[model samples]
Target: MIELPTLYHLATPDAWDAEASDDYTVSTLGRSLAEEGFIHLSLARQVSGVAEAFYAGRDVILLALDPHRLSARVEFEQVPGVDDAFPHLYGPIPRAAILSATPVPFAQDGAHDFTGLLPEPL
Candidate 1:
């Protein structure tokens, strides 16, 4: 399988805009990095499901992050009943790791649709 160079982070616009520093250091809100110890992430195919379940009608942004540039350790962990593992970054993220930030589009039914936002498969 071909591995993409980047991964996606689903974030609130206010959280990203307010907290992301000029130096590229960012703290993810809701993920509770200090308490849970990691920031949640989803693969291209996984974004839709995650949005539907967690974010739903809330406005969110899809952040494109270069995995290689992240200061934290990213791990793909299996959750109960889920077939595929999800990516989790075990530390604060840096702005330099982010390649782009795009608003997550809403479907006619008012759910986040990540179709065009995700990177094409490499």
Candidate 2:
């Protein structure tokens, strides 16, 4: 399987404070997500469609998102069906967070090809 990004953590801007009981508008990004209604910041773009996927009824490997793109917080471990402090495992790492993303397969010139990598044992 292609090893684009091995791990990922959710991303959101800190526009809102916990003390405030209101939601911010993410429509500025593109479209409002159906479930959480937050903007998908639009930074996950990649060679594979799944890698650059939005959060509308879908799950994409984010690897790491940038602090500039962080408009709000995700309330912690918001990955559907995944409960607990899972997000904490990655901590507050920002977009530049280096990850084991897969190298681009098949160079545009078609002369080079990515050998790919082995999956890290979880």
Best by TM-score: 1
Residue clash pairs of candidate 1:
24-95
After superposition, the stretches of candidate 1 with alpha carbons farther than 4 Å from their true spots are 1-4, 22-29, 120-122
Best by lDDT: 1
Off by over 4 Å in 2: 1-32, 38-63, 78-83, 86-122
Number of backbone collisions per candidate: 1, 9
TM-score of 1: 0.83
What is the per-residue lDDT of model 2 for residues 12-116, given as tens digits with 9 covering 90 to 100? Answer: 233322233343332322333443344332223221322224333322223333333333453334545533222222123333332323333334554223233
Q: Each model's TM-score?
A: 0.83, 0.23
Which residue pairs overlap in candidate 2's backbone? 4-102, 8-63, 12-71, 12-72, 13-70, 13-71, 13-72, 65-95, 66-95
Cα lDDT tens digits for candidate 1, 90-112: 88777878888889888888888
Compared with the true structure, the alpha-carbon lDDT of candidate 1 equals 0.76
